[model samples]
Target: MNARGFTEEQEEFAAAVRQFAAKECGTREQRAVLTDDNREQHHDSIYAKIAASGYLGVSIPEEYGGSGGGILEQVILFEELWRGMVPVHGAGTSHTVAGVYKRYASEQQKKDVLGAICAGEVMSISISEPGAGSDAAAISCKAVRDGDVYRINGQKTWCSDAQFASKILLVARTGRGHRPHDGLTMFEIPTSTPGLDIRPIRTMGGGAEVNDLFFTDVEVPVTAVVGEEGGAWRQVMAGLNGERIVCAAQGLGMAQRSFDDLLGYLREREQFGAPIGSFQAVRHRVADLAIEIEASRALTYDTARRVAANEGAPEELVRATSMAKVKVTETAKRVALEGVQLMGGYGYTLEFDMERHLRLAIPATIYAGTNEIQRDIISSTFGLRPGRS
Candidate 1:
């Protein structure tokens, strides 16, 4: 590791990404045009530029036309982009789906799926049905095995970027087993598959990125199954844990940005004929926030280091990741809220980026397993159970 616990190569790569962000969407106006003045969550023109920069393949292996980097590089990309205010909403999901394909896909599947992703096409995960948000094992989306294919019929909600993605990583129940988690399978299905519908869900965040995906008699070849047919529960669980660091990286960046904006406001905004930061109470609050942001940075990078050192994380790392996810995300939300309160009406306006930060931070706690779930995981790892120590 080099400066700030990143390797020298990673540091250089982050500088390059920062420069790319500065050149592309460095200003709020540039980002606004890319996102159509915040009405859109994704823009093809900007995303095409990002793909051309090869940042899309930062964590993907080189064999499949990627940059052959690892988790750390992906974290840098995510953190720097968010810090620079580059709104590539699809990058997170696409990066995650590549990991799935890398881990479970057959050679041909990797060549096809990962190739498309590296080539600038995006991917979305199809989990979280109407009844299966937290309890993913309760998935009711059924994919029954037909003669030569599987016929899928169900609706998946809260699927991000499904409308614009070239592929979707779907989790559908194929059978029943001892536990609800068993007998589920993962599938890679093209977005253009028959009997599929994508409907945009208007959210308060002012983006049409999330959607509901409907499948009626959608048929996929039996070969589309990823990993074992009846063993996707384990696959999905590990995958979620693995992606926790990604969220932490993103949250840390957001929190830092919020604090930076707040600090500048406190220094410049005058009240009682002096800068508000000159007041002891305001100074104390700002100091507290600074400490919290620093703590979040430490926790996130320390967890990343442990994960990198382990080659792969042990089962215990689940709790570590859960802790990092909750701390970073909750801190990010708090910073945004505090920034809004301190900046008064200015923070709430579209003129400042604080409201956008708040919009993005609010969902981090709820999605990808809620903060409550993260705490539960941490507690359970401490041996908490029904009538147990």
Candidate 2:
């Protein structure tokens, strides 16, 4: 079903994506893919095909070789893609990161990166250092300018999909002070650059999607700087705002999918000669899940509208994003957990997608800033300064 209030064009796009997912992509055995390079190769090849089909750059401007659609279209695409299990869901994170380059890159830089990204060349943002995490400004990765190049030295952890990324949107400190946010700069660092090392970090999810990125004397030309020197703090903030909204879209999609699965199980599974869905407890829980999903969708779409229209996001936008992420992702986790519970032994088995949805939801609270940090962002907005009156 189309999102409430979606335009006809958006509905048509959703239909198109659903049709593509079902007919072309087929069902995904994502667990098997995680263990084998061949599966990843096949996955990337599929992404390249999608990129060629012109849907990969859905909301990017036409000038940048994108469809120039708004974020509402993007939201619909995410929902449909997740519903379809089309295998390119995580790749959109790279495309979203490319927005920083599109907005802040010089014309030549934009031409170079945006073109490659539109063609499905993978790039990832490297902002989370071991010491940084949610307090991103506290990143200690240092970049020292030397003539035409900036030499970088430090380690970045939790670099998603680094094993496959072609380039990294690297954030480093160019100036020194105790102020964490000051004197930061962003550069497009090719992953193959000398002195850059990437090693996969194993996790419960089994995807090896996160990595440790080490840079020692890695150098990028001055031309690689995305925006003005030392202006990266604000630039990254803007990109992050957009990132949170995009993440909320993903979270909403996963939640919806899990809820749908749960509903199906409840309708079909028999308990005491009656469908589980006939139970008051099960029905009430399902209704609550539906309500929460709809609420999350509304907030996410509203935030997308503000971003796409170039309007200043309300101060609450951050908290709103945080709320959406926290609620929707946690909701996804709940739905997945209870889905597994309600489905009995089958839910815990590898044969089901509910477990994978649970794995995916676990990381959502950690990425794009953790839920605890999100609460801080929300609390900081209330102006709790003492004696201000």
Candidate 3:
């Protein structure tokens, strides 16, 4: 009966998350303090609050220190958090790493890693390299097995939250297979390991959320491997479904925030003796944006439910998740831009947060695989293939 058809339990959980975000993370000033300097103290303080609320382990197994909920719970939680303007830096990456570990990590690894994640420790994944962004399998970082250990070397770009992460889930080239996607292996390595260096990447949106990582012969034990050696492609593909869904949720949350802010501004800011929202053209524009937002929410929620139910074959899940990702992100970008335009001069100022949302939305379409790549995946699902002219 909720707009998106949330169950009673889900609605109650969302209410709790909304309360938490309002009390603990509501203001831009509060978020600024929490994410400043990319320091561990701020990250820990905020995430500890979240973990205490039992959100950090949603969708993970109870035996592994999680709440044993389904993925839809996570989608709901993230949507609420972002809608409240909470910065989801560390928790987002941690949840992603938790998903990978849930399926592939050894029992002991789960006890250690998943437990730490639930306790609010940040974990990052390094996949994209300088030469490989969209082409993930084209990464050249090498992880050569030497006896019982693997020596890792090379660099990774856009590795978000590495500065605060306790460990990094690294993907590296182990050997060549018949296809480029083969021979990639995943390893969990301590961020403090010798020869591993992390440098922050500053952005216009204003946060130390991303980093460039350089590994100079860093070594990890064979036990560090998450799944079968040389089988990371399959593992990564499986994990991407979760990634896309989460990204879609993030976009939807941001879009909702943008729309809410614009509506508030329109209602109060009068022009020519009447509220600007009373204008016909403005009202029509708002109506169109509202329609798009609802459409995006429906698609995202439906896809999330399918993911939770394991309702389809892997390929079908890929298509559904990709569609969600593409639609929600594009909708977010449009909403954020329109929000800025609606707010006029105030929108362009740092005093208002709409500009920040715009900056964040711009990158959403690019990261988590560009919308162009997502379109290709959707086409392939319909038996269409790329071809030469």
Q: For this target, which candidate reaches the highest lDDT against the unseen true structure?
A: 3
Question: Residue 278's C-alpha lDDT in candidate 2?
Answer: 96
Cα lDDT over the full model 1 = 0.86
Candidate 3 lDDT over 109-191, as tens digits, reads: 99999999887889999899999998987999999999999999999999988998999999999999999898999999999
lDDT winner, 1 or 3: 3
Worst 10 residues of 1 by lDDT: 306-315
Give the poorly placed runs of model 3, Cα more than 4 Å off: 1-3, 35-42
Greater lDDT among 1 and 2 belongs to 1
> Candidate 3: TM-score?
0.96
Give candidates' CA RMSD values in order: 1.8, 3.0, 2.0
**Candidates 2 and 3, the one with greater lDDT:** 3
- CA shift at 179, candidate 3, in angstroms? 1.6
TM-score of every candidate: 0.96, 0.91, 0.96
